[model samples]
Target: MSIRLTPLGRMVVPVLVLVGLIGLNGWLSATMGRGPWLDVDKVFHLAIGIVVSWVFYYLLRQKHDAVPHYGFFGAGMMLGASGWFPLVSQGLLFSALPDWDITLFGIGSHRNPAFHSALIPFFLVIGLLHYRGMRDFAIGLSVGVCSHLLVDLCQSASSHPDWYRPNFYPIVRGMYGPFAVLWMLGNALIAAGLAYGAAGRQPALVRMEREGFE
Candidate 1:
């Protein structure tokens, strides 16, 4: 039998799943007596990934004129976005894979130009071109990585207070103080706008409400 959801359900369910995963992570961290599984920077990345993935799903569904399996698609996007843990001989590294460069090179600084560079995502998307039928997954992962870097840049700026043009590295000194906060707020606003637009354009959303997925 096929499963389907109403338009509202399509949107609500994925959000619920995101919330559930975050809650589970928090609970696990508390029970395991561990530091937060993800630091605040990483938590920002996770939130960006979930929001971007959900918006992208609606956009793709609208563009393709296809009724995607919303639940499955949403879950896949979330998984791809947040799947950064890598096992080493010592233990599992909970940070994003790109962050390994800092550890590998023994960079004591939390913000590394190489790892947190904004250019990295552009290259990642270009590299993903070799893999067909995986664009959505790649996009989700790239968004997550990029957002992580952006958050790190903000945090670094916040901590340093005097750093300017810290994001692009050697090319430009990053802005600090109010600038970082504005940058973050701008990103949040863009995401919210895209989500709203996608919701408006989803042709199949209401259909799901009536007929459900088949």
Candidate 2:
């Protein structure tokens, strides 16, 4: 016999597990400080973000009275973009929006404000989410961003080579200072601009129907 969880339970149990994994990693990092055991090999944890995506998807699906959950229709544009049509185009890149600094400009730093800091984009998430038809799209886009952070957090917690800074700096990089600026703008603007465009798009057939082309 297998134990099954309810929808809410499904969401809650995994979150608790993720938190515990993070805490365990923290405790190990504090005691070990990148100890010799990992000196000969590297460890990268990518599973956490995939797990957390469920929570993100769940929260994004909640029915808000005013905006309502747009379901598949609201998120159709992004799903297609991230899906097999082109198979992971811009939507996948949005997951790494913060890395634009190094990838595009060749600037590498411990922490960059442009993309790492959440001061501005935090609010942009709320603003974009409130738009009439953007709820699911915002959720899809934000899951990518949040998963980006979760991957960093996992790296920092484990003291992996990719993120050797202290947990505070690597996890949040809260006070770091951005094309350095554009990273932050990139984070928000990419999501907002994409969502805005996707939201306004009407299929050509629909437009033709309205204009009597068909």
Q: Show where candidate 1 strays beyond 4 Å.
A: 1-3, 33-55, 65-95, 127-140, 146-176, 182-214
Best by lDDT: 1
Q: TM-score per candidate, in order?
A: 0.48, 0.42
lDDT of 2 by residue, 1-214 (tens): 9998898898888878778766765665566554323411112122343454455445434532222244643233222222212212233332244444444555444345555544333454467543434545454444444444444543544554433333323333353222322343355445434433433332442455467764
Error of 2 at 28 (Å): 20
Error (Å) of candidate 2 at residue 73 is 11
Residue-level lDDT of model 1, residues 91-175, one tens digit each, is: 1255564465555665454334444443444454455433323433344444455445444554455456555544423211243
Which lDDT value does model 1 have at 89? Answer: 18
lDDT of each: 0.46, 0.43
